[model samples]
Target: MAGKSGRRSENRFIRYLILFTWALFCLMPILWFLSIGLRPRIEIITPQPIYWPSFSLDAWKMIWQDWPMAKYLFNSVAAIFGSVLIDLVLAIPAAYALSRFTFRGRDDIAFYILSTRMMAPAIVAIPIFFLFRNLGLLDTIYALMLVYAAINLSIVTWIIRSYMLDIPKELEDAARTDGAGDLRILWEIIIPAVLPGIITAAVIAMIFAINEFLFTLLIASTPNAYTMSVALANFTGGSDGVIYNAIALVSFIAMVPVFIVVLAIQKHLSRGLTMGAVKG
Candidate 1:
């Protein structure tokens, strides 16, 4: 009995140590970015490698001074929020029909929509660029917003459809028997039940929109419509070459909103992701 108990204790300690080390491995880059962002640019490139150099705010100050950080931030915010709005508006009706109603070729339609995501973004980029240019919307915020919405709508539909399937059909039938219309039932019964899933979908869409680089860089004509990701890449390029400390600072600031949003909606996110694992 003593030998068995001793072995179990050692095993538990080893498991915890392994988990902690993995977490540290993931977080070390983020910590290094923060460290560099607070250090002077000269110390960052020191031959001896100054790990604990004296802290300074020079990098962050230079980043704000050299670029229109506020304009880029505003454009990114508009694109993400606008994309989420369009997605949610369209997804509700599409998911409802897919889950609750019987229609001709419904399954085929759903599969076709999902398959769009399988196509490589690179393949569509050139055509989309030409189309946007012809429409005279190049470098426009609305154009990027619409493109982001279309790109992310497939995942949103899939998620909401899964949640909608879990809602009881009897509830909708009960409302209909009481003379309730389709819109009334959808607003009162179906929507409330699937609110958690909707919130999760919106957050995921927002994150993808904010992180999108290739489309924004290709489609946007000027810095006025640029996103933070493009700005970060530009900071490290051109005749001036890379500025490691400034890049670190911008990267850190760019990541803060995503981190806060994920933390804020953690419970809803967990529920949405684990909706079908066990019978609810």
Candidate 2:
């Protein structure tokens, strides 16, 4: 009994050590970035860095006053929200159809939808650019929002459909017997049942839209439509040269919204991801 107790304690110690190491690995960059953002340029550029650097808010001030940070942040929020809304509005019905209906070529259509994601964005970027340009939609937030929605539509449909399949048909059938149409059944029955999966899909879509760089860079030409990602990229080269501290501050600020969103919906995220893994 003593030997067994010793083995269990050793196992616990090893497990905790592994978890601590992994946490450090994940947190080290964020801590370093925060440290940089708080330090002055003099301390940041020194060959022998200060471990506990003196704090400064100059970077935050520079970003707020000089950079169009507010506009970029607003654009990022608007674009991501629009994309997620469009994705859900379109995906829910398509996913419901895919899940509940049995028409000819259904499998083929599903495969085709999923196949769109396999194409790299670069492969289609030029065509999309020209298409937007021809439509006189270049350099607009609407264009970016539409592109993001289309890009994420396939994955959202697939995820929501999987979750919808896990829902019992009996509930839908009972609703149908109560004189409910397909739309009513979906609105009343399936939507409530699969809401977690919808939330998961929306969160994933939001993250993708938020971090998207190439499309935004290629499409938006003015500050009016520039997102946080594009604003961060502009710091790469400037007339005054790159300021590492300022860049770090911008990076930290850019991540705040996504962090808040993940924290808010984490419970739903966990259940949503696993709920569709196995069908009932």
Candidate 3:
């Protein structure tokens, strides 16, 4: 009994140590960026680096004033929300159809939808760019939103379908026996049941839309439509050299929305992912 107890304690200690190490690995860069962003440019560039620098908001002010920070932020928010909305609207019905109904070529069609994700963005960017240009969607938030929605639709549908499949069909059958139409059953029963999965899908779709740089860079050429990612990249100086502190400040600002979203939906996210995995 004593030997078993000792081994359990050792395992607990090892587990905690591993978790702590992984946490540090993830947080180290964030801490470094926060430290740099808080300090002035001189302190950041000094040969003897100051581990803890005096907090200053000058970089934040400078970047806000010099860059179209507000516009970029607004554009990012608009695009992300728009894309997530579109993804959910389109994915939910498709997922439900795929999950509940039996139709010819259903599996093949589902596979084809998922297979679109296998193509790299770069491979399709030029053709998409020319198509958008021809359609006069270049340098528009709508264009970015549309592209992001299309890019994320496949994965979101698959995830929601998995969760939908986990829900017992008996529930739907009961609703049907009671004279609830298919739309009514979906709206009243299945939707609430799979709400967590939908939240998870929306959060993931938002994250992808927010971080997507390549498509945004290609689609949005002007400051009006450029997102935070593209705006951050624009900070790459030509002759003045990279502004480390400024870059860090803007990067931190860009991360704030995503951090808030993840924190808010973290519970639903875990439950949704677990349910989806177990059910499928």
Candidate 4:
């Protein structure tokens, strides 16, 4: 018994050590960014890596005061939110129809939708730019919103459809037997059952939209439509070399929205990922 207890304790220690090591590895880059953002100009310019650096808020102050950080943040947040909203609005019904009802060319239609995403955005950017330009939507947040929504819609529908497929068909049959219509059953039964997947899909769409840089750069011809990613790029175009501290600060700030959003929805996110993973 003592030998078995000792072996179990050793195994637990090994498990914890592995987890700690992996977590540290994942966090090291963010920690490095934080250190760089807080360090003074001298410490940052030094070639040698400093183990411990003096801290200053000048980087943060410079970013907020000297740069149009607020405008960039607002544009980024609005575009992502709008895109996710549009994705959810369109995807939920489309996913339900694809998953629940049998129809002609259903699989073909789903594949066609996904195939749109398979084409590299770069290949189609010119035509899309021309279309939006003709519509006079160049350099607008709404244009970014529409572009991101179209980009994310296919994935969102597929994710929700997959989750809906996992649901037992008996629930729908029972609802039908109870005289509940399809829309009612969908709203009360299907949506509630797949809420986790919806949240997961929305979050994924938001992250993708936020990180999108190419289309944003092409569309944001002016500072008025600049996003966080574009603003960070603008910092590198300086004649006096790159501003390491400013770039670091912007990178860190860009992470804040995603971090806060994921943190706020951690329960749903973890459940969405894990709830069905260990099912019997």
Candidate 5:
């Protein structure tokens, strides 16, 4: 018994160590970005990466001052929110239905939705471009929003449905017994029970929407509607078609919102991710 206990303890320690190492590896690039962003532009582009900061915000200031940073930021905000809103409005009820009831062709319907994600955005970009052009949405924030929503809808629905399934049907049934209707049950009971999951899905969807580049590139024709991901690409162009320091600075700016959200809600994300890994 003593030996078994010792082995278990050793295994736990080893597992923790492995996890810690993996986390550090994942975070290394982010830390490097921070370090680079803070350093002098000259120091950042040196043959060797500077371990210490020269302690300057010049690159960041220059990026904000020289570029339409505000416009890019606004575009990103608009795109992320619009996409998330569309996804949630459509996905919540769909997820609830899929989770709470059985109906004809249910698995087929779910599979159809999931299968949309398998299509590459690049493959469909030209058609979307033409479609948006005909709708008079070309070079507009709305076009970016629509494309992002369409692409992200499948993921949001799939994720939310899994979380919905983890919620006990008995709870909703009890609400129904007490005179609650479907809408009431969803609004008051089911939604609250799965709020964490909803938040997790929203955050993930928002992150993906914010970071999306290809669709943004194809759809947005003007700087007014261009997202940071697109704007960042502009930094690497010229006869000298690559400003290494500016790239670092722009990249850093782009990652801040995503990093903060992920760090803040990481626990919820972990829980939501595990929601449907097992049957109740």
Candidate 6:
């Protein structure tokens, strides 16, 4: 028993060590970005690696004052909320129906929906551009919101469906016996139980929407529609040379909302990712 306990302790220590190492590896880029973002431009561009940098706020000031950062932030936040709302509203019903009911061509329909994700976005980018252009939605926040929602719809549905499938059918049967309708059951029982999964799906949708650059680049021509992701490009070009510090600031700005969201819902998110991983 003593030897077994020792082995278990050693294994647990090694597992935590690996996890810590991996987490640090993933966080290195963000740390480096912070390091570069807080420093003077001279230190950022210097060939030699400096152990420490003199903190400077010139880049922060330039972005907040000189650039229309508020507009970019508004556009980004609005688009994320809109797209995620649309994704949830649309995906929830599809996931519930697919998870709880069976009908002709149901499998085919689910497959078709999932297969949309397999289609490369680049192939449809031009067509989508022309479609938005024809609809006069180009250079509008609505265009980005719609595009982001569309891109994430299938995955969101599938993710929610997986979680729903994990729910015991007996629960629904019991509810039905007590005069519960589909909508009532979904709202009262299933949704509450699967809240974590839904949050996870929303997080996923927000992540894609926030980080999307290609569609925004093609559809949103101006700053009013383009978000923080594209705003980084403005720092990389023109005769003044690359604004490395500005780029770092933009990267940090883009990451903050997502980071905050993930941190706030980390408990649910951890459960959502693991407990929601069963078959659909």
Q: Order of candidates by lDDT, top first?
A: 6, 4, 2, 3, 1, 5
Model 4 local distance difference test score: 0.91
Candidate 6 to truth, TM? 0.90
RMSD of 5: 3.5
lDDT per residue (tens digit) for residues 1-280 in model 6: 9999999999999999999999999999999898888888989778888996999998999999989998998899999989999999999999999988999989899999999999989999999999999999999999999999999999999999989899999999999999999999999999998999999999999988888999999987888797998888888889968999989888988988889899999999998888965544
Quick one: ranking by TM-score, best first?
A: 4, 2, 6, 3, 1, 5
Point to the candidate with the largest lDDT.
6
Top candidate by TM-score:
4
Worst 10 residues of 3 by lDDT: 271-280
TM-scores for every candidate against the unseen true structure: 0.89, 0.91, 0.90, 0.94, 0.85, 0.90
What lDDT tens digits, residue by residue, belong to model 3 across residues 1-280?
9999999999999999999999999999888888898888889778985767888988888888888899999999899999999999999999999999999999998999999999988999999999999999999999999999999999999988888988998999999999999899989999999999999989889888888999999999899799998988876777757888988878888888888888988988888877766753
True lDDT of residue 35, candidate 2:
91
Which tens-of-lDDT digit does each residue in 1-280 have in candidate 4? 9999999999999999999999999999998899899988679888998888998998899999988899999999999999999999999999999998899999999999889889999998999899899999999999999999999999999989988988999999999999999999999999999998999999999989989999999899887889999999877876857788888989998999999999999999999877546542
- lDDT tens string, model 1, 1-280? 9999999999999999999999999999999999988998888777896656898998888888888887887888888889989999999889998999998999999898899989999999999999999998999888889899999999899888888998889999999999999999989899888988898889889888888999999888788788788888877788877889889988888887778778998888888777755546
Better of 3 and 4 by TM-score: 4
List where candidate 5 sits over 4 angstroms from the true fold. Answer: 1-25, 48-53, 278-280
Off by over 4 Å in 3: 1-25
Residue 142, model 5: Cα distance from true site in angstroms: 1.4
The true-versus-predicted C-alpha distance at residue 274 of model 4, in Å, is 3.6
C-alpha-based local distance difference test score of model 2:
0.90
Q: In terms of TM-score, how similar is model 2 to the real structure?
A: 0.91
| Candidate lDDT values, in order | 0.88, 0.90, 0.90, 0.91, 0.84, 0.92
Each prediction's total of clashing residue pairs, residues at least 3 apart in sequence or on different chains, is: 0, 0, 0, 0, 1, 0
lDDT of each residue in 131-185, candidate 5, tens digit only: 9989999889998888888988888988888888888878988998999999999
lDDT for residue 29 in candidate 4, whole number 0-100: 90
| Regions of candidate 2 where Cα sits further than 4 Å from its true position | 1-21, 278-280
Error (Å) of candidate 5 at residue 160 is 1.0
